[model samples]
Structures are given as structure tokens and as C-alpha cells.
Target: MERISFCPTLAAPLNKSEVASSRNDKSQWKTKENRPCLMVVGNDSAAAGTLKEALGEWGYDVVAARNGWEALVLAGRRPVDGMLVDMDMPIMDGRTMLSELRWLGHQMPVLIMSNESDEQVHPQLLMEGAQGFVLKPPHFQSLQQTCRKGFAK
Candidate 1:
């Protein structure tokens, strides 16, 4: 898998010492209490990258998983505050993933994303343990708001 980073370019170059100091500062800041960590699971690399960028801009620690199995592994390895899962995926679909995660005793809030009309599937997904649903190809603001709502739940 290709490694993708959403870091923005700085206006000016920092010296090595400055860079190390900034990294140290960021590490300290990241440990603050109540900071949310988000897990994003999607098969589409472009969509995953866009969601990761938007959620990171909103101050969440974002982790991207290319499939459901990878998502489950990551969730088990870390303390995830919320999850954004694409309903359609290879290896495992979102519904199955949600079920399995619940079976494994993960109680973190989950939001489902789908290209299909929400009218057709959102209700059932919600019944199955997902806290909410977002339409795929999501607008930035909508996705951000939906994620915020999921975290609130």
C-alpha cells in the first residue's frame, strides 16, 4: 500500500533543530486529554485522502484503512473515538465490519458512508449499531458535521 500524508507545505523552510523542536511540541500537544481519534475506512484512495484531509483540518487524529479487515486491526490496536466506514468495500463490507466490530466488543461510535441513496439503507445501518450515515462523495462541510455528530453520540 502507498503511504499517503496530508501535511501542508510550510511557507518557509525550518532548520533541522527547529523541525525537531516542532515535532516534539506536536507530540506533546497530541497527548492532551479529550482529543478525538478518527478511523476512516474506504476502498477508494482518493476518497479516503479527501476525508483524511478534512477530518485532520478539524483537529482529529485521523487513521485511514483501505478495507474493513485493516480497519478492524487498526481499531483493535488503538483507541479510536469514532469510525467512518464506506458501505461498499472489497474483502469485507461496512455492514459486516460493523457487526464484527460490535461482536469484538468495540463500542466506539460509527458512521456509515454510501453512494446508494440513504433512503434505502441508512435506517437499517443505524439499527445495526452505526450512529449515523453520510452520503458518499460527501461535501466537506457535511462530512465534517456528520463526523462531529457521530463523536457527540
Candidate 2:
């Protein structure tokens, strides 16, 4: 596994399928994402850095956004197949970002990664149609497994 160099999306014309496929070889990740895009939104540079490392190592194309507004703005123009969001973020919270995307009819599978150990990921709390949630800095293998599982679903 290698720590791929990720240049944050400063708003560009991104191809969804190309981005998703960059995470892994098509043969390894055969999940039906359909849309071909993966959005990773986080305020913490460290968290985003870790995810970029994972996603890059996984060989998936990634679009990194620093906050909720940026994510929504980027996602609006490009169709994302999947997304990983941080629960506590600046500008807008993860819940709000997810809600806005849903409102706009984006159906990408959104995964939430949070540092709030005391809080659990429940349907009632995850209002943005998010499909998965894993606490931050989980065991490396567990985090990897969780990400794989999320994309699988």
C-alpha cells in the first residue's frame, strides 16, 4: 500500500467513474456504484489525510473537500457514486450536508466517519441517507473493512 498524493478538489470537472475506479482495480472492486464518483468531505486535515491515504492505497479516485458547503457545491455539478463524511465539521455539520444532497436528489452512498466515541451511528441521527458510519481512528484493519463494506453495500 502506498500513500498516494492527493490534490484537493479546488472545484474542477471530475469524472465520477474514473474517480471511483482509481481507488481499486475494477477487477478487485466490482461493486455497482453506477455513478462513478466518490466524495470525501472533512474539516480536519489530519482525518482527510488519513482517508486520502486509505483511498489512494485502495486505488480509488477521490475528490476531497474541506467542508460541507464545498462538498455540496462540488457534488451538485458532478454525480458522486459514494461519499465519506466527517460527523463534526466546520461550515455545516455532516447531517446538514447529507440532507442538502438528498434534497437535491443525489443518491450516492454516504459513509460517516466520526471521532465521537460516545455517540453511535443510528438511522435517526444520520438524516442524510448515509449508509455507513465508523468512529475515527478505528483499528486500521477495522477501518479498512468498514470502508470496503460500505462500498460493497
Candidate 3:
């Protein structure tokens, strides 16, 4: 199994008052305990590392998982505010992971990140549950905005 490295620049945890205030308003966008917790699942170590770094720079606390199975275990142990999952991987693919996650009652917003073009991706993934889809080597700003939108609602 490959190692998953996390960036070391995460923001401090949120205080109780802050959590209370954020939860009081359903319309307000809440960060995960001050910094949003993002789980990034992909098979390529280099790509996942790059994404982890970028997301960390953007103020997210990121957890990198090599495949969907690993992602599921990580998600089960902690609360993830959002997820960015690759469409293809060994052990478990993103689509199956999404289906399993939904069946298990995990409603965390998921964004599919794949090498496939929009036309190549299956429509069922979006219709079934994914909050959004992003092409691999995503534009940083666009990815960031998509993440923000997922957390907003």
C-alpha cells in the first residue's frame, strides 16, 4: 500500500462558540472545525500529493487516500466536509464508492475528479449523487469554487 501524506499547515480547530454559531444558520457556509476537512481519493500518488498541497494552501485540512476502500475507512473514522474522488482506481472505483457511501447513509458532498472529459463521463454519476465533476489537473480557482459551493449548502 502507498503512503498518504498530509500537508502540515492546517488551521487551528474551531471553538465551541464558533461551531454553535455556524450551525445556527443553515444558510451560512461552515468550515470543518474552523478549517474544512477534505478527503481526496485517487490512485496516483503524485497527483494526490499535488492536490493535497493545493487544497492545503487554500485553507483545507486534507486527507489523501490511495483508493476508494482506503477513503471509506478514513471517512468512517472522521468527519469529512467534502470529498474529491477519482473516477478510476484499483481496489475500488469512485462510482462504486459513491454508491456504497450513499447506501450506507453518508451524505457528504462528493466531487468526481477524473481524466475523462465531460462527454466521456457517465451521466448516472452526476444524477445519482455527486455534487459536481472536475477534469483532472483541475484549474485551482475552479476547484476551489466548486468545493466552496459544496460546503455552502
Per-model TM-score on C-alpha atoms: 0.76, 0.69, 0.74
Report the CA-based lDDT of candidate 2 relative to the real structure: 0.67
Q: Please give, for residues 1-153, the per-residue lDDT of candidate 3 as tens digits.
A: 321222122122223333334434543444556787788999999988899999899888898899877776666556678899999998778887787666545678999988877664557787779988888889989988888887664
lDDT of 3: 0.75
- Residue runs of model 3 more than 4 Å from their true location after superposition: 1-33, 118-122
Clashes of each: 0, 11, 0
Lowest-sum lDDT 10-residue window in model 2: 2-11
18-127 per-residue lDDT for model 1 (tens digits):
32343344343354554688889999999889888888889888899998877876665566778999999987789888876775567889988888776857788778
TM-score of 3: 0.74
lDDT of 2 by residue, 1-153 (tens): 432212233234334344444433434434454324467899878777777777767756678899887887677555556888887887777877776666555677888777774444566555548787877766668866776777764
lDDT value, residue 14 of candidate 3: 23
Q: lDDT (0-100) at residue 146 of candidate 2?
A: 72
- Superior candidate under lDDT, 2 versus 3: 3
Candidate with the larger TM-score of 1 and 3: 1
| lDDT scores in order | 0.75, 0.67, 0.75
Q: Which window of 10 residues has the lowest lDDT sum in candidate 3?
A: 2-11
Could you tell me the lDDT of residue 14 within candidate 1?
A: 23
